[model samples]
Every structure is written in structure tokens, then in C-alpha cells.
Target: MSGISRRKFLTCTLVGAGATALSLKTTDAFASAKLEGYPDSMGVLVDLGRCVGCRSCEAACNREQHLPAPAQSFDDPSVFDQTFHNGQKRRTDEQAYTVVNRYEPTATDQPVYRKSQCNHCNEPACLTSCFVNAYTKTSEGAVIYNPNICVGCRNCMIACPFNMPAYSYSSATNPVIKKCIFCYDTRLKNGLPPACVEICPQQVMTFGHRKELIEIAHERIKARPDRYIDHLYGENEVGGTSWMYLAPAPFEEVGFDTTMNNEPIISNVKDFLGTVPMVLAIWPALFTGFHLLATRKHDIEQHGDDHSAHKEEEKKS
Candidate 1:
């Protein structure tokens, strides 16, 4: 409306749509592809039954990552009783990459403690959503982030189903996302387990190749059916993840989202995005045909007016 004619406006709209589609083509390719992950990628298997809520893993992660000291010390048991707004469990934040949450299931008197962190999916939504390519899925099965190239879009946060990635809001400048990267730089790339896995006294986590861990988890469950649930969380959820869980209680009771289907989060998004390019391609030609028809009609009207004027001039002569 800002001094733009109808044809010019339509032309701009078509061009903009086409440009958007072109930009998203690369993202669609990443989202739609079947990513089975590296064959020898490392993974962690969390046994919920073994965790004692000792907070040693939290302390180890804090020391290993060199994060700032929390208001509540890692040694304090009061952290387990803490909850955020809406009575939600404490999640990973700028300060804490991993947090242990206590869940009291009605089925058992003993409370279940769940360690929350980045699951590092085989086909990560964070990697697909980041337009700037800030997120990367390592061949070692770690989902790492590059803050140097990050535009502070936080698209990864929304894309992650686990709600793991946290932004560093405390830094007024050069703030970046903070989350567990499986200790890629210090230990994982060197073929060592994470600090949390090593420091845990109860042996709550088992670090090994992803394929081998799956087999081990199934074996453990089969040997003790009464002690574990049949389902292995993260085995197929969101197209599988690097980290998996074996719990004695139902997953829902331990704060897992049970409604998610086996398909990756980006799969449906890619399906919708796939049509956008086709629509953009068709619209330009379709609207150009309309513009041509309108211009031809205008030309015909101008010719008719000239003919009328000529007839009037001839009559006057």
C-alpha cells in the first residue's frame, strides 16, 4: 500500500516467497534425511534403579565443565526438593548442564531419581532448526554447539523435545547456549566416559557403543523382568537417541513424555516444508498470467478510448 501498485505488490510477494523457499531447501534436506548415526558412535545407558540421588554426578559435571558455582551447593540435598514456576522440575540452565530430579512414584515407597541432560538424538532437531548451523552432531554421538557462529536465534531450544538447551542470559554480550555435549572436548573424543559416569558411585550409567548398549539394556531387562520395565526409553523415541534409559517404574511417572511417536520431530516439519518450494515455483507463473490478462484488458480499454476520440474528431472535421 506504500505507493506500490497491485502488480508490483504481487511481483514482490512472489519473489519473497521464492527466496524463502530457496533458503529452506538446505534445511529440508537435513530434516528429511534418514540419519542412522555413526556405526561406532558412543552412548550412555542410564539405569534409574541404580541412582541413589547422591548428587555426585552433578558435582563431577560442574567441576568438569568449569561452570559457575550455584546458589545451592551441589552437596546439598535441598536441591532435589526445588521446583521452578508452575511446579515444574528443575531443568538444565546456564549454570547447570545436568540436574538430578526426584520423582515419587505412587507404586513404590522409594523415590526415583532421574538425571536430566541432552539426549543427543541420532537425528537431532536442534541441528535441523539452527539456520546459522550453530549446532553440530558429532560422529562420536555428541550434539555440540558453536557459539562463535551462533546468531542467538534460540531455535534449537524450541526444536529440542527434551527441553535441554539453556541460554546464557547472564552475559549481556556474547551470550551462548549451554547444555551437555557428552564432554566431547575433554573425554568423549578421547574414548573416556563422561565425568558424571565415572564419578557416580552406584554405577547408574554405562558408557559403550550405542548398538552394544542396546543389546546390554535388553539383556538386563530380560534377566530381571520384575525389576525393570519392558520399554527402553529413547530406543525409538524421536528416531532414537544416543542416550537411553532403563527404569523400574513407568516412564511417565519419572517425567518422560509418553505421547511422542517414533518419528523424529523434524520429519513432519520437513513434509510441510517440502510443499513450500513447489507452491512458490507455481505461484510466480500463475500470477504472471493474471498480470498479463489485466494488462491486455487495460490496453484494449485505452484503444477503445482512442477510437472514440478519433470518431469525435472526424465528426467535428
Candidate 2:
């Protein structure tokens, strides 16, 4: 449950006596440090096959976060019909932290609804890309935002591959980037499930330790292989995320970016930033040493020329 990949082949009963736990861990090119979040880092596993598109979670989120009253009521089912010009459905914005988008992979099959929100990546782009360092990955695995230091830069919005963060464009003076915070302030800090998780009537999502949830995700896949697509959405995405998913159809069908690299978004940023200190400390001395050697060579040549002239005068005497 600590995100540590075991090398030894150990037989473990997960679902039943017949089923076996597969020792499959995603390998990244960076071979970098594993951010298992905290030892007891909490996360949420969303079963997209079970979601009924009730928006109960959204209502619960609004109430828990004390957001402004929405234009549409919680009971409104018309929100499902919402669509954009490019055929993409609604996404998470300042008005809504979580949104249920309808997806129809095939013409004959029933519509599959997917919820979008902050995945809270273990190595978050928002946290690393922030010019003001506004975002934080908590020990509990909740990637929370601090508005006080936000500075309204919105670098997190640009850095987030999930496209989860939104800026409050309406606010002129004190605008800030807004998005799902995993209910860190009210419920999670108190060792309770998030309001959205608790309010989900269909039991579509479960909150627990991030690593434990990964096992549970695999167990669910093993238990019902036919129902699931066999691919876990957030398992290795951006170096794994706290909020993971199990879907009936491919993630690409549900409007997810499948071509993203396994490396954490900040891995490149770290590589670039990691060089700053090295360059600052090493380059000056290295270049200065080269300059000193060049000057010494010029001085030696000048001395040799002077010595040759003195010998010529001696020969003339």
C-alpha cells in the first residue's frame, strides 16, 4: 500500500482463492522518486460504470464548499444535454469543481457518463509550475490551493494537463484559480470521506489510502473483467494520481487524453530547475579557469619573444 513494487513472487489471495494478485507496477523512464504521497495518503477510486449521472455529488460538493448558488438547481437533469460546438460536453470550471459528462462510444450502446475533476497527481504540475507556489500536495494526498499566495498568476491552469483548474475571470481585484480541492479543509482533514464521495448514492466512488485503492482497483478488475476495460485511468498517469478510475469503455472514448507520457509533469521541470544550482555554482569557476590559462599562455609567448630580442642584442654586441 506504500506504492513500493515488490520484486519477490509471493502468492496472495485478493478477490478469491481462484483469483491471484498480479504483480504489475508501472515503470517510468525517469526512474525517479516515488511520490506515494503520505504513508496514509487518502484517495478516491471512481467506478465510472456505476455512476448514474444523478449529480448528487455535485450538489453535495456545492453545499460542503459553500459555493455560490448555481444557476441550475440540483434536481435539474437538463444539464446532461449540455454540449459544445466541438461536441465536447461541459468541464470543471469556477462554477463547478466536479461535472458529469455524457459519452456514447457506440451508436447502439448506452451512454456512459464520466465525472471530471482534479486528479491530484502525486507529482502535480500545478504545484511545480506555480510561479508563486500556490498549490500544495498534502501528506493526505489532497492537492490543495492557497488563495493568499496565489497572486492570480494562473500558471497552474496552464500546467495542468488535466485542464482541471480555472481562473475566476469575473473577480477583478482578488481573482484566483479555482478547482476541486478533494474537500481537504472540511472533511478529509477530519479523517472523513469527502462530501461528494459521501453523497454519491450509487456508491460509484470510494475514498481510502492511495496505494490501497490501486490494489482495490485491480481486484475489481479481476473480479469482473468483462465489466471493466482492463485499463486503470489514473494508475500511471502523470506518475499516478490520488483520484483513479475504472471505466467500462476506453478512457479515450470518455474524453480522456491517452497519449500523455508516463513521466510526471514536473519531472522535466525538475530537470531544468535542478540545473540552475549546478550551472550557477560550476560554470563561473570553469570559464574563469579557462580564461586564466589563456592569459598565462599569452604571457609566456610574450616573455619568449622578449628573451629572443635580448639574445639578438647580445649577438650584435
Report, for all candidates in order, the number of backbone clashes: 0, 0
Best by lDDT: 1
- The digit string of per-residue lDDT tens for model 1 on 6-79 reads 87667767766776676577566756577677898899999999999998988999999999998887778897
Clashing pairs in 1: none
lDDT, candidate 2, equals 0.81
Q: Model 2: residues >4 Å from true position, as ranges?
A: 1-34, 297-317
Tens-place lDDT per residue, model 2, 156-229, is 88899999998888898999999999999998889999999998999999999988899999999999988898
- TM-score list, all predictions: 0.79, 0.82
Cα TM-score of candidate 1: 0.79
Identify the leading candidate in terms of TM-score: 2
Error of 1 at 121 (Å): 0.6
Q: What is the TM-score (0 to 1) of candidate 2?
A: 0.82
- What range of 10 consecutive residues in model 2 has the weakest lDDT sum? 18-27
